[model samples]
Target: MTAFQQQLLDVNGITLSIYSAGPDSGRPVWLLHGFPECWYSWRSQMTALAEAGYRVYAPEMRGYGDSSAPEDVAAYQILTLCADIQGAMDALGHTDVCMIGHDWGAPVAWHLGLLEPERVSVLGAMSVPFGGRPKRPAIDIMREANVGRFNYIVYFQEPGVAEAELNADIERSMRLLIGGNSDVFLHPKPADAQFLAGLDVPTTYPEWCNEQDFAVYLRTLNKHGFHGPLNWYRNFEVNWQSTEFLAGRQVLQPTLFLLGEDDPVGKLEAYTVKKMGELVPRLESHVLSECGHWIQNERAGRVNELLLEFLGRHYPRAGIV
Candidate 1:
């Protein structure tokens, strides 16, 4: 595998730390990591794709890692995040590249289809499913649905509330969140719901994210407080308002969607599967067994296989340098 290259890129008025590898001439494939995760989250897949002869670009995202984290919650809106991707593309002078996103990144990728389907060659998402826009804002709906329950997204609505809980203990938060923190309110079971279940979140850490891997996340988040990451969840309504017109818009890109059987987030909305297929006309769905929310980590090998197959099908790596 080629050694990873690190650089700070100026994009969308923010300086982003991007890690990339593989041949510069190889077909470009950008990988996006979700909340609480850095480009390192795609370390395994980066090597896999890079070795498969595709240039891989993974950024720490605006709010995470060495990247710039703006204080305003509005700065973290969906359109801004999408601009970051486009800005990176313009900076890199590349277009028609495939995007693979996990967790929060999934929605960003799906939104790209709505925002600029022509900009993307294809799309792949994990953990989160793309259902059409809601009748009302999502946070409003989540508050009512998870009433007296431990819904993390709803818990994240209030400012400083989740930050206080998460910033108080970074390491513990990383451990539980990675493996579903089955005991936390983030888990579907109401019996385990607590005010801030992320507080008791030290029990389960997925194999891929061991003590060493988690240390990287802890140190990174410690450098940049939870304010920026938490701000991502804080912008639910703003993002809803920005892209309100695109509501119920169908994603025409050829897409591949993957999920873990044990992911509680997958069960949050019952309409994801039906809606995903309906919106993403050309969709290939796969669910890995014994996996949790972290599908790319838990099932790295299989995930790479699927990605290579899909990318190879659309953008053949036969003649590219």
Candidate 2:
């Protein structure tokens, strides 16, 4: 396995700790991690993609890892977050790149491609769809749709709720989110007693999670806390208003969407494929059977295969435009 090299890049007033792989002269791939995750989330992908002859860079989004996190809540706005991606690209002298993001990172990737199409060559998203936020804030839409269980998004908007609740029980919450417990919640009814017993039980879940990997994420957030990351949820209405300008803009770039069959986002009646296809016409979708929200970690081999095929087809090394 090729070892990863870490570097510090100062872009847009934030210093990002970048994990990079592959030869310096190769085309670039930018991997963006979602909430509660760090650049470490893309560790497996960086090595694999680099082996396939592409340069890969994964940045711990602001507030998440060794990256700088500003105290102002507005600093976390989606637009500002999107700028960070551009700044990262410019810092590396990349005029265009293949962009891949998971969860919250997906939306930022979408916006980056939409607003600055020339800078992105292809896009891949995991665990999230591309319909954009609803006309109303997600809270209002969820309330109207009667998805009472979606209260978590609203809870995140509340100042200090996520930080308090999630931070109050950091280890368990980390285990739950990163352990793929979101899969347990996706079931139609209460999971079997065995399922409940499966969680927080024997602690074997940490097998896939290394101590140093988890520490990088836990320490960063535990130091800055989750408030900054949670601010992404608080910007629902602001994001809606800002993104309205791109209402008709679809991500025409070669795109791939991967979701765990058991992902809550997939199970939601609102995230239907028809809706997804309408918003992103060129999207190729796949649902990993039995996989969960953390598709990359839960089903790394399959996820890597799909990514390889998609990237090969769209960003082939044989030809250059």
Candidate 3:
């Protein structure tokens, strides 16, 4: 693996801390992390891709880690978030590049492709797949789907409650998320139950995530507060409005969808995947067993294998230094 360096770039009034590796002359790739996670999430991929001759940049994203954290909720709107990615691209002066994202970052990557298709080469998403916007209101869709255990999304819409709960017990929160602390976050259930139950426990990770790593997340989120990250959920209406025209927009670029079979987030109804496939006509889906929501960590080897193969298929390495 090649050595990666950390640098800060001031793009569009926001200063972003970016971790980058690989050859300076190689094709550039940007990896975006989701909520409750920072640029560290892509540490493995950054190393591997960099070694494979791609210039990879993984940013902490605004409101996470050493990046700017604006207090206003509107600051985290989808449009602005999309601009952050574009701004980063512009700052690097890269006209087009390979883009990969997970969870919240996946949606932003989707928006980036839609808003500026010419700027993106190929797309790779983990855990979350594109299903366009909800046809009916999200509430109506949830109620109709009989999604009982996943009530946290609706609860998060209330504001203050989740932040309060998460802040009250950072260790406990980390425990629930990583399956390290008492195997529970708030309630008493098996370490795996929280994830399998389909609740939006951002902290509920697997055992590989320990105290040292959890503290990194807690420190950043606690300092920034959950409002900015939660704002991603609050922008459903805005996303819906902006993406209405994308009802049947096809993502023509080569795409990859990686998920874990045990991932509650990935265990949505069949229609969701169907809708995603319909929208992204070129999507190739893969599901790994014995894995959960944190697919990248739980199944790094397999994820790396898939990513390497996909990139090779689309952008073969020819005669390049």
Among all candidates shown, the one with the greatest lDDT:
1
Off by over 4 Å in 2: 146-150, 183-202, 210-212, 269-272, 318-321
Whole-structure CA lDDT of model 3: 0.73
> Model 3, which residues run further than 4 Å from truth?
143-150, 180-207, 317-321
How displaced is residue 314 in candidate 1, in Å? 1.5
Question: Could you tell me the C-alpha RMSD of candidate 1 in Å?
Answer: 2.4
- Measured on C-alpha atoms, candidate 1 has an lDDT of 0.81
- For residues 1-321, write the lDDT of model 3, one tens digit per residue: 468788888887898889899889878888998966777777778877888888889988888877888776667777888888788888889887888898888888877777777878789988788776667656556545544443445556656767677666655655555563212323334322223243345544555565676676677676676666766777676667766876767777789988888766765535676568878888998989988777787787788889889889875433232
**Using alpha carbons, what is the TM-score of model 1?**
0.93
Ranking by TM-score: 1, 2, 3
Q: Among all windows of ten consecutive residues in candidate 2, which has the lowest summed lDDT? A: 188-197
TM-score of each: 0.93, 0.89, 0.86
**Model 2 Cα lDDT, one tens digit per residue, 221-292:** 776677778887777777777777787677788889998887777667344555878777788988899887
